[model samples]
Target: MKHIPVLLDAVKDAIGDMRGLRIADCTFGAGGYSRAFLDAGAHVVAFDRDPHVANDANMFQNKYGNTFRFVPETFSHIGEIDGLFDVIVFDLGISSMQIDVGERGFSFRADAPLDMRMSGKGMTAAELIAKSSVDELATILRDYGDVKKANIIARAAKEKLPQTTFELRDLVFNPNDVAPVFQALRIAVNDEFGEIQRALAAVPNKLACGGRCICVTFHSLEDRIVKNTFRDWTTPPGDARLPETCPAPFKLLKTVTPDDGELENNPRARSAHMRGVIKTC
Candidate 1:
């Protein structure tokens, strides 16, 4: 299935009138957000760790000329970029193309090597399972996936050390969701939460005055991170009794979710939420 960007219209609305604006498309999955920003007359620098997206990034560079730049790196290193952007946007989590491709091992429907690394680097899901103890695996499953039978599944998984998607999926006992187990393992393998935290940390420094930071998160864990970070960014410091009003460095923007029409068209967007904050200082 082709990748459909979730909450795209809402994101565009959040950044209103992008002409002559500089945007950093932090996730750049399938280049959906980048294309939309460019089409709206913005200069876009797209970043993605996954090498599979190079072809798409190349297409953007070729088509948009100097208006578009592709950075073949993770968003966590966003601080290293030289320019201050008018907007930074993140569409987090795996793209549909990754899951659809059976060889990527993001989905359990196909029997493939348990390689869930987004950048095709670092620890593979198979290696993660092999190295983690039953307790560690149980923690990952519980924390990331919210799996009910985390302990039971973790014990079985650690003992078997499944090297393929099918092996792991079959190893999961009945009445437990295999999807969450895979989700937890994939997040751990990619260090997704850590990546998100680091990328957002750079936003305040990378954004120009009055610039905005936007994030579209699909799951509660990531959504909570964005929400808390944005809150911190927009909250004012100092004593409340001073009466010397100290304005927050950033101001929170409206939160958006998929409308009925979008949900009908893309069920994957049902869980998506878009939150944004504008730099006030």
Candidate 2:
């Protein structure tokens, strides 16, 4: 499956046209934006926890050898990143490549291993669920998946906890309930929320003045965090007593959605919400 970038034109405009600027794509899934930025004349350093992508780096590097670099690390560790990034993009959550292929275990649509590691580390979803307490499973269903019948889901999940992809499908949820359960397990296995939180904390310090950070989230909960952070970072006018007014930590820029054409072609594009923050102070 081709990884057609969501809001490609808007992302280009939001990142702005800058010369010799350093841009970071935290989720360099299929080299969609990284390739585009490099083409637009910027130094691009992309990150992806999945080392598997590195195997294909030769393809991109061969084409754009001098300017492109792929860092095999999560975005949350931006503190360790060497230089400031002008436009730091966080396209959080899974990509279509993972979902389309079954071996990676991201989907319940086809059969594969129970593993759902975005970084290809940590316990597989099957192992985690099989060994976890019913309460633990219940919490995962409720908090991560937001399944209405979390307790029932937990009971079913626990029963088929150590199962492979199809095994768990049969044991935990019927065909209808499968998707939600799969989503919850995948999020927990990837620690998506925790990583985003850690990555967000480093943004204010990592970005240069007037630099922008664009984040596209696939899930409602993830979008909620990004929205709240953008709002809070506005740095409202407070403490009028201070000699000089404190500048806003960041400026909330636009929230963009893919056009209806794009959404109709790629339903995955439907749930996507893109927002940005620009450093103003």
Candidate 3:
């Protein structure tokens, strides 16, 4: 299946008039957002932990030349990048490419090994399950996936230690749990929440005044992180009635979700939400 970017129009609307601006594409999955920025005459520096995306990055580099650059690392290392940016964008969560290629083990629909490492170098999902205690596994399920039968599934997972996607799916008592179980494991395997926190921490210092930080999040856990962070950025410290001397660093922008047309074409985007904030001096 072709990887259609979720919230492309919404993201574009968030960062209006990209010409001659500097953009940091924090998650260069499938080169979707970066391509859009480059086409609009913005200079883009893209980062992706997955080594598999190097080919797609190369295509962008060849097509965009000096206007584009790719970093072969996770967005958690965004602090290491030099210079400030006019715009920074993150398309969080797994790309369709990761899910489509079943060998990568992101989707349980395909009978692949239970390996959902985004960087292709970390511990596999199977390894995580085997090493985690039942209590630890239950917490991951409850916190990350919000699985209804987290305790029961955790105990079963530890006792059986399934090594493949199908095996893991079978461990779940309810059909509805199959997706959450996979999502919880994927988040744990990638340390996705930690990565987002670290990456967002660097944004204030790296973003130019009047610049924007936009995030398109897929699930509640990730969306909560983005929403809370944006809220903090846009909210004034202390009493709201305090003098106007100390202003909030950023101003909240419009929040967007997939429209009916987008959902009809890409049901995977149904849960996606786009939130953004613009830096205010």
Assess the local accuracy of residue 237 in candidate 3 as a C-alpha lDDT between 0 and 100. Answer: 61
* Number of the candidate with higher lDDT, 1 or 2: 1
Model 2: clashing residue pairs? Answer: 130-161
Q: What is the lDDT for 147 in model 1?
A: 89
For candidate 1, write residues 163-243 as lDDT tens digits: 899999998877457989999999899999999988887788888889999999999988999998887776666634212
Each candidate structure's TM-score, on Cα atoms with residue i matched to residue i, is 0.95, 0.92, 0.96
TM-score of 2: 0.92
Residue 193 in model 2: lDDT: 91
Alpha-carbon error at 131 in model 3, in Å?
Answer: 0.8
Which residue pairs in candidate 1 collide? none
Q: Which ten residues in a row have the lowest lDDT in candidate 3?
A: 239-248
What candidate 2 gets wrong by more than 4 Å, as runs, is: 237-248
Clashing residue pair totals per candidate (backbone < 3 A): 0, 1, 0
Candidate 2, residue 208: Cα displacement in angstroms equals: 0.4
lDDT of 2 by residue, 1-281 (tens): 86777777778888878568899888888888888898888988888998777865667788888788878888888868887888999887887888887998888777888998888888889888877899988898888878778898788777655457887777654566678888998988888898998888778778888889899988898999888777767756573321131244677788998889988887888888889988886
Weakest 10 consecutive residues, lDDT, candidate 2? Answer: 239-248
lDDT by residue for model 3 (106-216), tens: 998999999999999979999999999999999999999999989999999999999999999998989999999999999999999999988888888788889899999
C-alpha lDDT of candidate 1 relative to the true structure: 0.90
